[model samples]
Target: MSTENTGSLDTSLVAAAAGALAVMCASASFAGVLADAGWLIPALITVLAVVGVGVLGRRLGWPTVGVVAAQLAGLLVILTVLFASSSAILGVLPGPAAIAELARLLGGTGELIRTGVPPVPADPPLQALVCLGLGVVALLVDLIAVGIGTPAVTGLVLLCVFAIPASLADRMLPWWSFALGGAGYALLLAAAGHHRRWRRYEEPDRVAYALFGRTTAVVAGTAGVIAVLAGSVFTGVGTEGRLPGSVPEEFGGTDGIGLQPFTSLRGQLNRDRVVELFRVRGLQQDSYLRAMTLRKFDPRTGWQLDGLTQGVDANAPLPLPEGTTIGRGRPERIEVQPIGYRDPWLPVFGTPVSVSGMGRNWRYDPAAGIVFTQTNQETRPYTQQVIVPDPSPEELRAARGPMPIDPAYVDASGISPQVAELAQRLTADAPTEFDKAVAVNRFFTDPANGFRYDLTTAPSTGQDALSDFLFRGKRGFCEQYASSMAVLLRSLGIPSRVAIGFTAGYQDGTEQVITTEDAHAWVEAYFPGWGWQTFDPTPLSDGRTALPQFLDTALHPPQTPAPQPGQPRPGPVPGAPAPPVAGAQPDSRDVPQQRREPADRGWSITVLALIVLLACAGAATPLAIREIRRGQRLQAITEGREGAASTAWREVLDEVRDRGHQPRDTDTARQLADRLVTDHDLDATGADALKHLVTAVEREWYAPTAPSDGTLTDTLEAITRSLHHNAPLDLRSRLFPRSALPPWRTTP
Candidate 1:
């Protein structure tokens, strides 16, 4: 083969790897999205399918369009069923109804994309949309960059994917995402543009090839830096890119989750780390600062807001509280400063009157009574002038109006009947609605009602979550207490919404440092004249996190990992802390509860070691079988009594099978010679060699006596070459010989 032809063989492999890297680059954006882990499997399948089909297409002589079309069809069928089918009604794959359901889930995407806040506790609709979106992107990158042989075009497609997510989110994208995307595009350009040295020409194009390589690297490197920098800068991977991409060690970086807020699903209310998110000054009393209020409740999906949101400019006069007599009411000028946490919303005391010395990204909604920023909003220090009202018990009782609260609060369409009944039983004594609300809040959080605060509890979703929290072992942190209180109050005709924000931090002189541990939620009951008042039904203190007296025998999320009477549960725990069972928790310091002993250490280790040895032996089995067969042929030569005949004949049969032909095991020495000579167009020398071997074996077996053989090694070697020359160079025939494998295991 020509030198150029040898290089072309290498080019194809490099191109295939480049194509996979391109898909990975685009899929890297998924890391910031909520369902990132779920997207990885589908993304991998897409890349592998593209490369696999491309290889097969080359062998089958298919065009580029055909290969692209085949890969697209396969990926669509796979991803649609994997992601969309399970979520569909009745679990049918590729139905119109399922497609419609997927569309319905994706309907509010524009708003979600615009908000750019990652909705944790994964929205099923959003998961489906992301799965399909990335699949299509992978196909486009594969076809345009790899199939069309212009890898430079892939940079544009990747840029669009990176820019949209980065513009919306302030969180930094991981550095590797940019690096991989760049490397893939550069490799593709090199493979397609200059690596095809196999095509022979009158003159070599060394200068042109060298120039193209240099150009591709410079362009690819530039694109990579831009894409990665955009995400990292937003993520507090800061502009300098010096901050480590991973969670720091002090913050339980063991599992990759750094300190985040209560905004995430089942918040990691850090049990240890003290990394301050921000600092606040002014309010001496415990300040409940609101970030994003989750008001709109859906039965199928839990807390989400789909209401009308109107935006006002940053410095614009925020609309005063409706029907408010509570103006500048306990006015507190709060000075806030950010440490490392980057948030779009500047945590401020709500019913925020005004903000100064901030960027233009901030916007306010009169309806929600909250101020948020969009553009330069990641943790900018701002001094907010807020009106904090503390209406007394007497004033709150008398506070009444036309009920300007949204009708959704009073609808109570999906509140659990158990919760409603419980509310009725709890509030039967209270004469007024305001008093009844207070009674309900106290009843739920009262330690006498068997509730305690534990950050490790698993939260439930949907309409009946209140029922689970109340009836199924009432032991959760602040979210359960707050959410249940709001639902129960709503059931009793009280207007309420769940407020998400941080609790008062540990004070340092005038300044208060708020850590991730302080993130909390509380219920706000809307009163006509007094406005929305925050209530804490959560018994944060004075109660051990252990479950109630009544629920000792009951099974809850926290207790799921403990071994039952007839069961032995193994493996590290799921998303809950160590269960208070089987000595998992210490029973006093001295002579603590003994852990259950595991089975048979010596026997298990021995068995495992044997299994590993057997597996290694199995891998080398082909080489072993080849050597054994060769030794048997050697025994037939020099040492054996009869035969130049048996040695020569066995060599010919072994060569034919090794070179990609499977002949009958029963064929005699002479019969094998007849077939090999005719089927393979062997020369006269090869035919003569085969004839002499067959005659010798026949004479040794059937004649009166065995003949001492003349040199038959040359004859056997000639026949072997003829067989090897005609055999196809497919992977299986050369490396994986039929002789190395058993007769029944051979493929046609």
Candidate 2:
């Protein structure tokens, strides 16, 4: 086989590989943000496939545009195979069904990106989304560095990738990720520089070339360090503050607030010190401390803090839930002192009748069944007179109908088919709605099902995630159990919502001290005769959970009417299932959770805007840099600096190169100027300017004692203006100047 100039194609693949390495390093920032690293596999495959397509197309003698098109098509096919093969034609090509499936997956990904806290589950949808983004990045790197031939600009694209995790991560990104990103960028620069050396210096001096190579490495390393430090400082990774702004509590008048109960609950529980959030006094019986109620269940997202309760005076008597009799509820007074917690929502026990000793900023929303404040949730002591409903087993058993006040309470639109079928199967023999609810709870807590409370399980809520939890990996924390049970109830045509708060904490003297470890979630099913009834499904081996009176009565009835003390708390109907745990604790390492403090909505939007701006800026960076360098060279000529004649000549050649003309290495200054005049069909002004520049350049090279030319800068500017006026395609040249890249050789 005859030798072919395949150097350009080889260099392109090298640069593409550097981009892949950089992206993988940046992906490490998501280690704790996502449940696992499974996304990396598909993303790696996507980048590799894109590079492979470019190499194949170039080897076949295709033009740059055709090569790029092939690369994009290859990306689509790879993604279809990985994520949407079921809907694809021949399980390879993307058809209409495949496109629709990809769109649906992206839609869910958008919702997750918009509302999710860090450490969201690494499900198939999320992996697909990640692969798509990184694939696009790879294509851009190939086109810009190899096709467009400006490898230096690829650094800006890499920065965009690194910024994502830096902005969203709950903790500081690992140090190795930053180091790898720097090394990858340096490798890319070194590769590009090496290619340029081979082309520019035919008989290169070893000492000079080595010095130039060292300078390039130093510059690349310095740029990388500066970028990482700037991003860290600007994103405020280790600080509790946002980017110098306050977000609206209502989040642009959106219906629901962002609540990451699973993330935050796990974080608190895993903390080294058990933080006391609230102290409950005057509690004659155990009850779950109500923090907030999430009434909306999105199949894409588990639970949402939907809609605001109508604001009423803090001291006013809150309206009772619908279907609740006013006098049937037994009244109880409880005093609560918030200690270390600061949130928009306040915690209260049972249904609030009235609240005392709180500021006017606090308001009760009876419909939503929680107390909230728009101003602040500063630590304060308050007293509440609330009613705890005591519905007997007979009343709950007779309860009929779904009884949905709002359709959201019973909306099961996006449930997985397998999950819906499983719900039907589990409750098939149950005679009543109450029995169906009990059966679902029992299925989870029953040891025969092999479900275990493990904090390390991925807390994903997608269809695939739900199937994995119920059918395969039956392990998770309170958030999983509560959300799963609530979705199951809705699938059975029952009204249900997930409640988040602290369980009745360990009793300490006269007060029940609720700690961070006590953060809990449970299902509340609305019965027709009664209101929302508590059902705990998480099986905690710990003794922190309290059995609700109604569930206890329904499961195991007393033999006599009179109450008996120390009855072993009705040991869960003799092997039916145990009462759920109070909350979750740490596994091996602490799972860093989304901060429970006020969400920095404005900060999030600002960071996203900055990332978009960086991408836009990256595209135009070469043009901007070329313009700046042009100005500096012209300024040096005007000041009569050394080498003014050579500077003027080189500037003219670069302008010629940008306008689609390449001056050969053997061409003299006079010969190049003549070609530019003839090719561009220059007018008298342009021809005269080129003649003046050519004379100065020849004198500078041949005559050592020649004086500096006074009119060199003016002549260069005149030629540039003439060139702009003559060439119709000068605008394209200005934006993507060909002179920014080194000349490359290719053979068909």
Candidate 3:
């Protein structure tokens, strides 16, 4: 190729690269808006690919490897920019420590990958990788086709072949999808062949291509603008589908449990399952399936489970059964770990001694170890004491009595006879109600007995789910286990109910934040005399115990072993503090005391206002200094008899106004200068000098040329003297009469 052709090719490649870079940057910056505009990042990349091909064709360049590398680099740049900006892409990736500072400011570290803020909503990281891969492939095809002198029409056709699959891959696939999509796109592009359109050369006057390009640009710009406007409106409005408005009473209130109006039926069923699981365990203790408690149940809507009522007299006593032992022994420290949705209901093992730091509406249900809150809010983890009656083994073994079923519990007479028969058969060979309960608990808890834990939603076979679980699919989660237990126990004349809470799992260093994933269902049954008891028959065989796995790894990280077995352990480094063992409690003496200063309204306000004023002044200092430096530079240039002499003169006119000289809006620069000189008592020489400065400034401003340094120096000196002599006693004070001044400023 000729040198001219090579130069053209190089320019075209540069232009293409620049265009691709611009598009990538734009997409990254406004990803959310682009999503709203239906202009996905993948689509933007395809457009960039098209632009690249066009540039390649015009410049007559053909370097596939270079194009692919350029595209990849562009993608990396886009990711970096988006990550820096705290856009969705940043949330998707797990960044290195170097980006931690940036991540902190952007609030990007916690967000889920591929999703925007509220990290849980984003697509997985694997999906993002796929989209990036597709982008690279698309660019490669563009480079190859364009370099071969493929006609613009032919290339345009080939571009679409690659674009569609890339879009789908980005939308559907995780990391692997990108490769698959890229392969498909490449195949399509290759199939389009090297057909070149002769029409452009045959009809050089054709305006179709130009019109198409302009139309595309206009459409893209318009869509972008609309997307921005729509996003602004949505953000202003805020999220529409939020959770329940009120808190649950179990958080800290005397109110009964109430459900949110729109509580999903699926959630209710899940909760019911948990209650059944407890029943199957046959513990016969009043266990709380703590959820949101409602005090002020709206008669119309039923119950608005708000948060715990503020300021309930928690010191008051909870009603307990007569003859019930109070403080019979030291309270058992039950550490509850709620693993699922951060609901407001606080869970405990038994009757609580006292709930500390609970909301006002919340109250401890001493009879049943549970904390009640008035409202249902997000879930959180807490520790509370439970007065668990640990009866002796002899007492438990000798216990024999009728199961104290709740009066409200319906008997099997209400159900089909077969159900009752099935329950009898399940409880056969048990001598007492307690034995039967034990039998039920063992059957469900025994994983070898066909019980299986699954996360998939089980299909509803019929109303008698217990029968189905016992005979059909043994695979089910906590809900199925609990439900089956409850139904069978109730059938056998034992009063039972379901309890829903989270299983203790991951210890979040200090305490685990109960995620929604840990939702569990169990059974609670009432034993005569002993009161209500808790039982959980859900098989614990699964890796649910993996919570300690994280803890173990964190606490016992692998370290280099000492060469000699009897050698003393290494001591602390010269300055650094010794590292604490995993789960070791900090020394009480080392704990820092937080001292709070007494509130002083007047002093606080005054201090705050003064600080704010100082901050403003500090921020403005740089701008003030910049202005002063510019003025000095102008003065010096004028004095040197260089360019900008006239500009320096005009600046002097502005200085006159700054010294409290009121000039008419339409006043000429000369008029303003003359007024300043006359009103400020400037000498005739100074006054004339001011007028000459104005003329020079106006001339330089309108036409522009090198300013004479001498002229600039003269104008600066004249303006400085005039302004200092006529300095305002507070510029605003001179501008307005005392009576017209604001009252506050007048006093100061």
Arranged by lDDT, best first: 2, 1, 3
What's the true lDDT of residue 659 in model 1?
62
Q: Which scores greater on TM-score, model 2 or model 3? A: 2
Structure candidate 1, residue pairs in collision = 4-198, 171-235, 172-231, 172-235, 173-231
Q: With candidate 2 superimposed using the best TM-score fit, by how many Å does residue 698's alpha carbon deviate from the native?
A: 40
Candidate 2 per-residue lDDT over residues 1-748, each given as its tens digit: 2245332234444545665665666566566457678888888899889878987887788999999999999999999999999999999999999989988987787656544545568888889888888888888877765655555667767777776666655445667667767766666655543333233222235323432455445655665574567456434532222211133233333221113433323323334446677888888798898777787766544576776655576677777765454336678999988765545566887877888886667777765677776542233688989888787766787876545477778889888888898888877767778878888888776666677776656444543656666765677777778888998899998888888888888889999998877888888898875788899888777765676887866555456444478654443232233333234322332333422433434465466547655664765576546654565576578678988988888888888878777788777788888889899988899999999988888888898588878887668767876886786444456456777666655331
Tens digits of per-residue lDDT for model 1 on 15-116? 566666666766676565453476566557756765666656755778988877777766655555665676654664557766665567678664444223
- TM-score, every prediction: 0.44, 0.44, 0.36
Backbone clashes under 3 angstroms, per model: 5, 1, 97
- The reply for model 3, stretches above 4 Å from the true place, is 1-330, 333-341, 364-370, 376-383, 397-406, 409-414, 456-463, 506-517, 543-748
Models, CA RMSD each? 23.2, 18.6, 25.1
Choose the strongest candidate by lDDT: 2
Go through the candidates in order and give each one's C-alpha lDDT.
0.57, 0.69, 0.41
Point out where model 1 deviates above 4 Å: 1-272, 299-301, 374-377, 456-463, 542-748
lDDT of 3: 0.41
Rate residue 496 of model 2 by lDDT: 88
lDDT of 3 by residue, 63-170 (tens): 655545555555554444443334434454334542453335334322232122111222323233334443553454444333342212222222222222222121
